[model samples]
Target: MPRARSSGSPNLACRSATTNCIRCLPQVEWEAPMADFLKLRDRMVDIHLARRGIRDSRVLQAMRTVPRERFVREGLEDFAYEDSALPIEEEQTISQPYIVAAMAEAAEIQSDDRVLEVGAGSGYAAAVLGQLAGEVFAIERHTALGKLARERIAALGYDNVDIRVGDGTRGLADQAPFDAILVAAGGPDVPAALKQQLAVGGHLVIPVGDPGDQKLCKVTRITESRFEEENLGAVMFVPLIGEQGWQEDGRRAASNHLPGASKSQSLPEMIADAAEDLPGFDDPAFGRLFDRFAGRRVVLLGEASHGTGEFYRARAAITRHLITHHNFTIVAVEADWPDAATIDRYVRHRPHRAGTDKPFQRFPTWMWRNTDIQELIHWMRDHNDMVDDMEARAGFYGLDIYNMSGSIGAVLDYLDRVDPDAAKVARERYGCLTPWQSNPATYGRAALSRGYAECEKAVIDQCRDLLRKRLDYAKDDGDAFLDAAQNARLIASAERYYRIMYYGGAESWNLRDTHMFETLQNLLDARGPDAKAIVWAHNSHIGDARVTDMGAARDELNIGQLCRETFGSDAALIGFGTHTGTVAAATDWDGDMQVKRVNPSRADSYERQFHDSGKSRFLLDLSPERHDALRRRLAEPRLERFIGVIYRPDTELQSHYSQAILPEQFDAFVWFDRTQAVTPLGPEHHRGVPETYPFGE
Candidate 1:
């Protein structure tokens, strides 16, 4: 265990006596004067680096020295140094200390290295890198996170670290050479651009694989033309959304054919197998359905999960593939359009710095800060032919059906001007009736009262009163609002309603219907049908044929239900599988190749014991068939080497929704065979196998 420095001693007296004493003191003493919160953090670092076998001394020292408490919300100070990850604004997470240490060690940062990190959440990792390396360049996609990171980094006096708000997959090419790059999120594959930016001997650490099973991987640039790969281990993270990763809207159909099937086989045999297992094929009329786009323009919708490195690479790959193979003329991203001119100028002229007046000065940092969803602006500006005729021919739009909670007030303000009647209803509902006759109910109140009206009036009156607070640019400021409205109009012209697509099945409302969702939905709805769209919500919404089965085609519905209803045939969906073996790097533990069991839910009986100690209420409920399968496999361990279980919450209600069970959602599970473990189970034995069409292509 790491111990705190002694509270008082001659060494401390000498340390405080002169400034030079501190600079010359042993590196360990730099952590002495930090708050107790940092002391706890240092202790955790010791456990992570020493016990966990993180051999990079630079990484360990950096982890120990950086004050994590300074990077989180003030209220969450106590948990600042905890081993578990914590939620930040915009649903992003500041990764746990151990995970950060592991990622940093994996990158193998050298003393004079320059590092580029994607998803600079909280700037904690960047701060750690600042201490370990010569310079750190970090990018955060979310504007709020970018602003917060800038503030925190400056406050900590980390002059060696620089942050910008931008997409990370489009690596900062202006600063082409980076010794190491660490992508904080999970993406489908390594991004080609990032690979190009890596210095000759540099290493790139990222997580690759589908969402279900991600393997940490390090790609090292051996020579200018050669590269080597090493699979590190397993991890779970949010999707990476950018130009190179998998876009949510792009759908690919996988076909599975049986082995040894003769061409002379009867049509009935093919139909029988197709109905039983294969994914339904697209309608032959698909060519006619999209005939309108032959001479006219085409706009593609790209879905991005902006923070994960894996998703970013996937989005980029998908974009390149679409442009190369599919003749996609115009690509509309989930970025802002107003900043397009600036992006175009940068791409063309390639300014080295923004000068003294601009908020960001460094060219590389500026490029990273402005290229995410914001890059859509640049794309539209450069490709004017795609969006020049919004009302008649083409239009660019953002399909961000979900809302960030903080933007509710802004949405309500916009609604107040655009649709006063709806605004009035919202005000009355939120109980914002006040003395000035303003609407407070717009904020979302279960019930309304006269006080709400008074509050609403007061708010509006205060805004009016503060209108001239800044007289010089007041009219120009008003024009800015007009510009924003124009942008909203453009977004509305293409689609009316914002679709609410959910990853988890509809049975769980969790964060989907919260204030943020409502705010975003209303904002998009305010735009009107050019802006209207069908939400591909979870199965819970569309599974109940009675509720969501309306006459509208291509409207709001569950994907699974939509496929079944549209095709009236079985369709295959691809999911990931996990394999266990030895990783490339070794430390204290032997790097052995063995069957490792992987499961979707990390929680097991051990965690349950802490939650419920007495009678062990929760049992791993297995059906009769499943129990029999387990018994048979247990008898012959060698025959049942690896087990894969498909976890469908809708099918296994008793297993997932029992009184003792936790209501977490998981798509599938994989278990590795160990010395004492046995029994392999297939889809039929699992609770929800029949519901999903499996295509292992």
Candidate 2:
């Protein structure tokens, strides 16, 4: 056996006077001032690293010296010296101490070796490498993680360690011929670029296999024309997410295809096999729907169309589970900020306007002012009433920028409460947009006609002013301040969105979604680190546009792609789809709503394939952890139908259908073989009109 640490020893707890993780730990000096930390670090090196066959003194010494606690998130500092891997931002984890020491040992670094570390992660491994190598170049795929790692490394005064954000699969070229390289993420294969960059007698260590499981392999450059590969051992890691590596979830697997259909399955066949049939929405078993969203920070619930009742009901149910069980604090929807503010107040138990027109008075009013939403808010209010802590109660927010005039009024109302002086300045700045606030699009048209926009600087300044006073104003009333600040932000983004809309398509769309994403981020921040949010939006806005024509053909970005890049596995996107159903939509933007019969999905569309699955309702888990073959099969390009507020069925294919790789679009797929229109809340809705076809494609 190894050594047994005494359960009551203080030296066992207190590191040496000159030891590691002292900032967070209780300093109980036995022989010396920092003996507890010292003993702890030494014990970790001996028990975790050395006992695991990490024999190299350099690796052991580096592990012994580096302060691992500095690498972990604030709350996790207490467990910094533990053997297991620790959680970090972006849903990625710092490697286990033993693994870090082993990888460093395998790299066989010389004192003056120029080492390159891929997937820098928490910068813990890089800091260890800095102790062994003269220079360290680290690459992290995510910009935020890399920046954080850089800051950490800099704080440690490790001037030799350089961390940059980029595709690590390509390696660093200009500063090539590294003596050693380590790739922390598992890739499909050892990247060819990394192999080429390895100097003769150099070694490149990487995990090669599926995203979840892999063999830690090392490539040693033998000569100019040859390299040798040795399997170190089996390991698991997050996929190396980038070009020249494993693609994001729902991306195609390199293998599995159809020749004679003997060894392979077609798209519909695969979907049928993988689809998990769901019970009735009211069934107790339906609570298990939250299983797919377990551990997620932001769960985006998508709708095939704005008026689908099943989509509304399903999302409301799932969100309820998340709130009651998981403490989800925010329900952000794709509606204007001012309109949502009223619902937010009602659900949060704030005073509501008694005699006012219900929200979503716009042409697509039924989308939000539906029975489904009414039920959800009523439950939310009940839940809020039961909670003793105000912060613990869930709140609703809107993430759209269509109501510029309303947003301006909200900002003014908020300013009138806290700081009238700043409000006065804001009014003066916002006054310029007063004439055109009612019709922002018209203002945009005029801006386009004049070749210059009015109130651009003024709106931007107003937004900045609110943000500048945020800290001070928040003390007076945090919720009220958030409302005003977000309204101001919506005004700013809306001003630009309306202006650039005439410049053409993608810019306006991108700005709108970006604003939505920012609103979600702000809500989460205000709610604190533990807050979770469920976003309700159209499929087109939440699906990963990068894998669809929205990005490929038109160069646009949506909240799904943004969340995926930022939150990685922590953000779950579930897209809803239907085959043939009755939908609530309009022929023109402001046209009256009609219950139209939706045609069966086109033969080539994924919706059609789901319908062919012979399951009335089911959930498709598109997470990488699911069947690899199924994802690869569905990864093939197929048409996806998107019916927005205005569904023009006369030109169905041209107006609604767009090609996308379904697997790459969402984390999960919720399919209703046939869905129906939402129950509009007011009696004035559902006017019996002439037989209107569904899916105004």
Candidate 3:
């Protein structure tokens, strides 16, 4: 459920590594109190716990009662019930639902009993304990995290659960003799203090072994001087840290214990069996691609990097074929609306609004300002020119929310034309953003760090005003009305977005992707219910994050996974990859553009598997049409590279690579053995970039 963790509730039973780790989970989403979440929670309990042999009725009830999403990272509440653990603050993780259930059951808490949970984490386990026991005491090593856990618990009204910050390995000595003690993190050995703190006849359950490797063990204090230990099962966890556990091991801060791909499976061979040799860009054999996605109304075409020429050319080619023969009318992208609208105007044969900035004028403009993109824009313009009806012509649109200032202007321009009085009111409302128009990020920082007022209400009001006048505006020009309303909505979204980047929640890689997803929805609806669309975005946005670290580990969601839920069989995803390449990118945010050399694919990566398959350029279909054996072979998560507008060769592995199961991450994989950089407008030389860049930004 990677928010396969934007998930509903837990099968939280056996999050593990290997066939072992909580990999390849079936993900779900949340809804009303008596809606999707309750049904999903029951399904999770039945399928991932009870069916797996958890027989404790109390434990099962506790699992079902606690709202795991409340304890999860923000924007990732959707993933609260996934089988896999989700990342939290302090580099810690909320234990997967299965692992928590298993440990809690082993602890054997009873009503009227006092329970202590070592390493409280997100307070998920403690909240569950509060359900079974009369009182629950939770200790966390990280003070800030403990405070957050306390807040989450209190907010959920778990008054029986009390949390504090301290060295948990030492246990709560003054409050000794707890009926049950559950240690969430893995330690080198059982802490003597914890065993001593347990009441006679009580249970102490802890994971014991080397870091990232452990077995859930239940120890029973049978008498004053005797104890019995029993092994539960193999499990993995972050290192237990304290005087009695692993000491200050920063390297173990890694969230997921999922390891590198095992060579035993012979994956490269399996991919070879299903690979389709693709023809060059100009070849008519693109008919193969048409067949692959012929039944799908919306197909997403993704790139390994934003600056690769081959990816751009190929997507442009496939997009061309789709629009020409498959009735595809929309080509949505991972770009800002205000910028893409200029290109949209070009493709739709409408005149670009005077004084509007040309497409991709912002930094890393190379992403859309390249010769390859220009080729597509020119072609789309020509193609639309040949069409009889404007509605039937292919149109380009952007689905990102970063163009705050531009959108404000677009909204104002529209209101001025249709209703001058509303335009004056809009200017007054949008005036709240005047100071930060040059740099919206500073506005968020100022709001958080300097008590600057947020413009959320103003922008939201403007958006509503525009929407309230939708009919009048639409009658003037429905298309323009759609554009204006969307921009207003984007402004409202971006205002909150910029402010929350410094605050907390209402955030994430999720907000941007959510905005993008919603924009796509608006585009499809504006076109019609039966419209066919093609999406062009980075692999991180188009490939299902549920099958990637972005979802399973990072507690993030993307447009790709959203489309899967929204459209099911109606949407298809295809991701591109490269073995080695030269790409145009910036070293840091807003840094100078540079043509960097992309390193060879990591040995454990999906790109490497494709490179080894001996096909320079080919397509591997992983759709339902493929054999189950092939799907099984590629199900194990492996490293996949994602190059954005920024690239860093030295930190490539950590910065660019993310864990992903190829078959589930995408409906198909497109591989290029070697590639070259996109030719940025007015540039043919190398330049120094920035020092640090955001991952997948």
Which prediction has the highest TM-score against the true structure?
3
lDDT of 1 by residue, 586-694 (tens): 1111122122222222221212111222221111211124334322211110100111111122211111111111111101111111112121122333344221111
Candidate 2, residue 334: the lDDT equals 88
Clashes of each: 59, 21, 21
Question: 1 or 2: which has the higher lDDT?
Answer: 2
What candidate 1 gets wrong by more than 4 Å, as runs, is 1-34, 248-697
lDDT string, candidate 3, 455-550, tens digits: 778888888888997887899998899999999989888887777654432243678788889999999999998898899988888888777766
> Candidates ranked by TM-score, best first?
3, 2, 1
TM-score of 3: 0.63
Q: Indicate whether candidate 1 or candidate 2 has the larger TM-score.
A: 2
Q: What's the TM for model 1? A: 0.35
Give Cα-based local distance difference scores for all models.
0.41, 0.78, 0.77
Point out where model 2 deviates above 4 Å: 1-265, 353-357, 450-454, 684-697
- Writing each residue's lDDT as its tens digit, candidate 2 over 1-697 gives 1122222212111111111221211222222224455666787787656754679998899999998878987666555665656678987888778778888888899999999999999899999999999999999988899999999999989999999889888889999989999999887778878888999999988987653235689899999879999987656567787766766773523432123533234456678888888887777566576676868999999988888899999998888888988889899998888888877877787665443334677657788878788778878988999998889989888998888988898898888778889889989998777877766667776677864475889889888988987799989888888988999999899889878755543677788889999999999999999999999988888889888766764567889899999999899988999998898876644568899888888654778778877889999889896888878667755667887765656445545666678888998999999899998776443345212201011
Best by lDDT: 2
Off by over 4 Å in 3: 1-265, 449-454, 504-506, 683-697
